[model samples]
Target: MTPQQFLQQKLQSRQYAGSYRKLQVQNNLIDFCSNDYLGFARSLELSEMINAELQNYPTILNGSTGSRLLAGNTIYAEDLEKLIAGFHDAQACLLFNSGYDANLGLLSSLPQRGDTVIHDELAHASIIDGIRLSHAKRHSFLHNNLHNLEQKLKAAHGNCYVVVESVYSMDGDFAPLTAIAQLVKQYNAVLIVDEAHALGVFNKGLVNQLQLQSAVFARIITFGKALGCHGAVVVGSNDLRQYLINFARSFIYTTAAPIHQLASIKMGYHLLAQSQLIIDELQIKIELYKSLMGDVPQSSKSSGAVQTLIIGGNQPTKHLASNLQQAGFDVRPILSPTVAEGTERLRICLHAHNSTEEITQLTNVIKINLHVK
Candidate 1:
């Protein structure tokens, strides 16, 4: 078959599955579907802080000239890594351009030949991809099923790494971290927690929040979501950081994050350091959103920023999301194969800046559209 025909077949398959995705422009809808949990993404104070931090540098460099191992390694970048490591209570921190790169770098490089890499079935795509890239044996436990994880751990053949997200992105649910930690300890398996969605929302993440830093072998934190910035960091022991610098292809081969992005990351952390009020406001809004929904099936058990409303079929889920958007709420449908076919959902991301009235209206419209009332 011709190349065009081959691509057409793939596109048709996606269309038939009702999961064809397309680019969408940002709209002026009432916000209910973004990761800016603390409103730092739109913070005037944050913008000003970035500007002020920019002025501190001796020279204005538009880009990181090379990889961190090469010309890209700067005193500023290394200083920020030190600050991040201290803030996260890690021995060392290594930066990546995004969470995808961090996960890809960590998972792909750490699990060696004959090692076993078991992750949650619902782990992020990047994690799964990284596992695929490794020479290790890989398996997945049922999502958040600790018993399944234990079984997998028992049967693991070699050195094992157990992976999970502290807060699962699509489902807006959390892993049973403390229980998982116990399992990891019992099995003598290394644990890796991706706190991409949990960082700003949970102060430092579930690991830091629960003082489980010592329990986990490594943690991946990202700035793109709740931190309202760009980039990610893998926080672990100094040895692991050094190893990643030497071996992680994604990190070793790519250009470093620009100075301005690093500035945003640094300033974002400074804000998080003093953001008890913002976090409190966010908790209040989360409660408000839940109470306003009033028996609407919530996908998240924790008071995290993400919430999912399950709609079984792709067409129905998309239709509901479109209805909510038409009513001025920016609700997005999480369709298969992004999620499973029967578990497609409308992913609602509550924010600190979202008003009670807006939340109420959004839920009421959802109820009216779905005939829930």
Candidate 2:
């Protein structure tokens, strides 16, 4: 077949499976779809703080003209890393353009050919992609199955590495971190936790909240979710930072984030440090949502910002999401292939800015639409 025909075949296959993806513009509706768990993305106060922080770096360039190994490194950037490292209680911090890059760079570069990389099956696509790039032997345990994880750990060879997310994105469930840490320690394997969904939602992150910082080998924290900014950081030991600086293709090859982005990160942390009341407000909304959901059939048990309602088919899941959209709630479907075929769902994200009335309305709409008791 011709190249066009090959591309068409793949596109057709996606369509046949009801998973054809499309780009969408944000609509003016109540948000139950975004990753802005703390609503920092839309916070006027945060925008003002970012603008003020930018003013402090007047002489800094608008763009990082080159990669950090070249001309992009700045005292401001280093200082920001230092600040982040200190906040997370890590020995060092290395910044990446995004969580994907951080995961890719770290996972791809660290494990050698003879080493093993084991991750939770429900770990993000970025984690999977990163492992694919590595030359290491790789395996995935069933999601949060400690026995399966232990089996994998037992069979692992040559500098085993265990990876999991502090808060899983799709299901919004937490990893068995403390137990996993103990298991990894028992097996003498390194542990890496992605705190992408847990960072701003749990203050420093679930790792820090649980005081497991020392137990982890590295923690990947992103600014886009709860922080409502951009970029990511790999918080680890000083040696790991230096090793990645020398070897991580993603970090060494890509241009560093601009001064404005770093300033935004700085101010984001500043706001997050003082956002306990805001965080509590988010928890209140979550509890309110859960209470309203009230054993609704198909609802996933989640305490985090992300909640899922399994609809079981792509068409039905999409239909429910569309109905929610029509009701002025921006709830989105997690379709087949993104999730398993029979487990398609509506992923609802709660935010501090979301009101009790909104949560009540949303739950009521879901219940009425599902015809639940």
Candidate 3:
């Protein structure tokens, strides 16, 4: 068969299964979907701050002209890494254009041919892709299950690496970090926590929140989520940073992020450091959502910004998401392949900017529609 015929067949299969994906532009509606949990993406004040800060570095170009190893390296970029390291209280930091690159670079390079990578089954796609690129033996433990993790750790060969997300993106639940850390310590495994979803939610992150920074071997933090910006950073020891710089293909080949993006990240950190009230506001919204949801059969309880209502089929979940959107709430569905087949859900994200009325209305709409279903 020709390539077009083969591609069409696969696309047809996805469409028939109700799992076909598409790009969409969001309409102006009550945002019940988006990773801007702190509402930083929409902050006019932050934009102003970033613009003001850019004046300090007048010569910085609009784009990073080359990779960091070549022409992309700047005094500002190096200083920004240092600032990020200090914030996370890590010995060193290395920037990546995005969280995907950071994970891909770190995982694909760190574990040698004889090493092992054991990750949680629910870990993000970036983690899986990074592991796939590596030459190491890989295993997946049951999601958040300590017993299963210990079993994998015991069976691990070579240098063992344990990976998990601090706050799972889809479920919005936290990993059993302290327990997992202790187990990793007992088994002499290196712990790598991706703090992509946990950064602004838990202040710095769950690892830093729990004071387990010392226990973790490395951390991947992203700015696109709650920080309302772009790019990511890997926080670890000076040695690990140096090793990635020398050996990671992703880091070596990619163009560096523009100076403006770095400036936005720097200002985001500045705002986050002083925005405890804003953080508290987000918590209040979460609490309000949970209280209103109140053990609804469809709703899955989550303390963080991400919450879900299982619809059990891709078509049904998508239908419900459409209904919510029609009612002026911008909620979206988690389809079969993105989640489990029987657990297709509407993933609702609550932001700090979301008013109490919006949360109430959104929950009421969900409950009413669920009852109708």
Candidate 4:
């Protein structure tokens, strides 16, 4: 029962389950698994833009020094919140250290003791964790199934909140937001959309892209993935903003992100706004990938940066990923219980910088490995 012994047993259990994860250093292989959809992570022009923006704040405070509730709230923080709010066309925006924190704080704080939180079964782990931390009763609808969600909402007793991802991270599919939004209204439930995978892929996100901003109750937008920066923002009403400030423990307890991180987020938005040609190129690459993947087992056909090729089983999926890596691709395997046992996959991320040749080569390699066309 010693703590060290307990930790060791858990690690052993993970190893046995074929889901143990470890940190990996970057390799110079052709990119296929990273979330850097817009290639902003490797954009030298973006780095220079951020550096130039930081120069305006010559006396930059390296860190926020404390939580937003305490010493962390700076003019920069306030301004950034406003800037983000304006960009997202929301009443208010509250910053969190990460997308995880944003979802954690929003779900944990907003839902009350009697409130019911019904989320998609395939929603991100952060949403699940946040729900676990809350006192609200939880239910999970089938992924992107409006009928199932309606049934859940119909039976719910208290304030109901429907949670979904704009673009699901695993299967790389979109939630039926327009349909879901209508359902939420019909059921008198609030809708919370996690736009983590939607930002750079769909201008601002599906909410903004489809003009569903006013329809959604709240949105969680992160900079790390598509923006290729750090931190996240929760877009909602002014009242919700104030409530989360006072009640969201994750936001209240965590140290604010550094000044440089905030500057990077701002610059990232600037780059995204001005990168039409780059974005168009990414779309072209994605189309090329889809056209080339004639016989590939695509989990979903929703158009976005992420695509999952379902390769069943842990060992087999891992082997395929390893083979792809050895063949000079950076693909990674998604093992169970991260995904269902029979649905383990190789998650591929198409980037703006990925050439048509790389896309064709990647698809061919996958076809050859998987014995497809």
Tell me, by lDDT, which candidate is best: 2
lDDT of 2 at 306: 92
Worst 10-residue lDDT window for candidate 3 reads 364-373
- Model 4: lDDT equals 0.90
Q: List the residue pairs that clash in candidate 1.
A: none
In model 1, what is the error at residue 282, expressed in angstroms? Answer: 0.6
lDDT tens digits, residues 109-173, model 4?
A: 88889999999999999999999899999999998888899899999878999999989999998
Window of ten residues with lowest summed lDDT in model 4? 293-302
Better of 1 and 4 by lDDT: 1
lDDT string for model 2 (1-373, tens) is: 9999999999999998888999999799999999999999999999999898887767877799999999999998999999999999999999999999999999999999999999999899999999889999999999999999999999998999999999999999999899999999999999999999998888999999999999999999999999999999999999999999999999999999999899889999999999999999999999899888876978976889999999998988989999999999999999979998898999999999999999999999999999986
lDDT of 1: 0.91
Tell me the TM-score of each prediction against the true structure. 0.98, 0.99, 0.99, 0.97
Per-model lDDT: 0.91, 0.94, 0.93, 0.90
lDDT of model 3, residue 175: 95
State the lDDT of candidate 1 residue by residue for 217-305, as single tens digits: 99999999988999999999999999999999999999998899999999999999999988889999888878877666634445799
Q: Which ranges of candidate 3 are over 4 A from the true structure?
A: none
Candidate 3 structure, TM-score to reference: 0.99
Error of 3 at 240 (Å): 0.6
